[model samples]
Target: MLNRALRLPTRAFVQVRSPRGAFDATLGNLSAAGARLVGIPERTIIVGDWIGIHCVGQNYSAEVRWHFDDTCGLMFEEPLSEYQIMTILGSRVAL
Candidate 1:
């Protein structure tokens, strides 16, 4: 079977907190299972680190899967439901 997860390009500011530190980052895209974070401070988040994200009135924990330059990929510990993805896409008042 094909993958059922959905991914979408997005632009939003979100908070990311890791054991190393907290950063102000831009969310490049989002999905039910993971997200791509952009513009992270160099050396703040490395691969295999656990981080927390505050986005769209919700908080999620994710693991850093990859890192390159100023961007990295995160896989959520608990995947967001489909409803949450859509809500994040449409929400403008959320920061």
Candidate 2:
């Protein structure tokens, strides 16, 4: 059970609330199980920390699985469905 899942790159602005504080980030890419968050600006987030991610009017509870170079990977507490993923990506697409 170790196949690398597909990821769709995105560039939506979002807010992340962690133990350190809330800050902005880019939704770099996404999949059903997790996502890549870029442009953290600050490197305060650490692995094993649970963070709340707010994007496009939706809130997601995710764990900071890895972090480095002002970027982090988040594993969603509950995997998102395909419909939800497409909806999220579509909402931010410029016309």
- Candidate that scores best on lDDT: 2
Q: What's the TM-score of each model vs. the native?
A: 0.87, 0.89
TM-score of 1: 0.87
Compared with the true structure, what per-residue lDDT tens digits does model 1 show for residues 1-95? 88756669888778899889998888889987899999999779889999999977788899999999999999999988888887777763553
Please write out the lDDT profile of model 2 over residues 1-95, one tens digit for every residue.
78898999888778899988889888889999999989886655889999998876789999999998988999999999988798778766644
Query: Residue 30 error for model 1, in Å?
Result: 1.1
Q: How well does model 1 score by local distance difference test?
A: 0.86
Per-residue lDDT, model 2, residue 47, is: 94
Error of 1 at 24 (Å): 0.9
Shift in Å, residue 41, candidate 1: 0.4
Candidate RMSDs in Å, in order, are: 2.3, 1.9
Distance from true position, residue 58, model 1, in Å? 1.0
Total clashes in model 1, counting residue pairs 3 or more apart in sequence or in different chains: 0
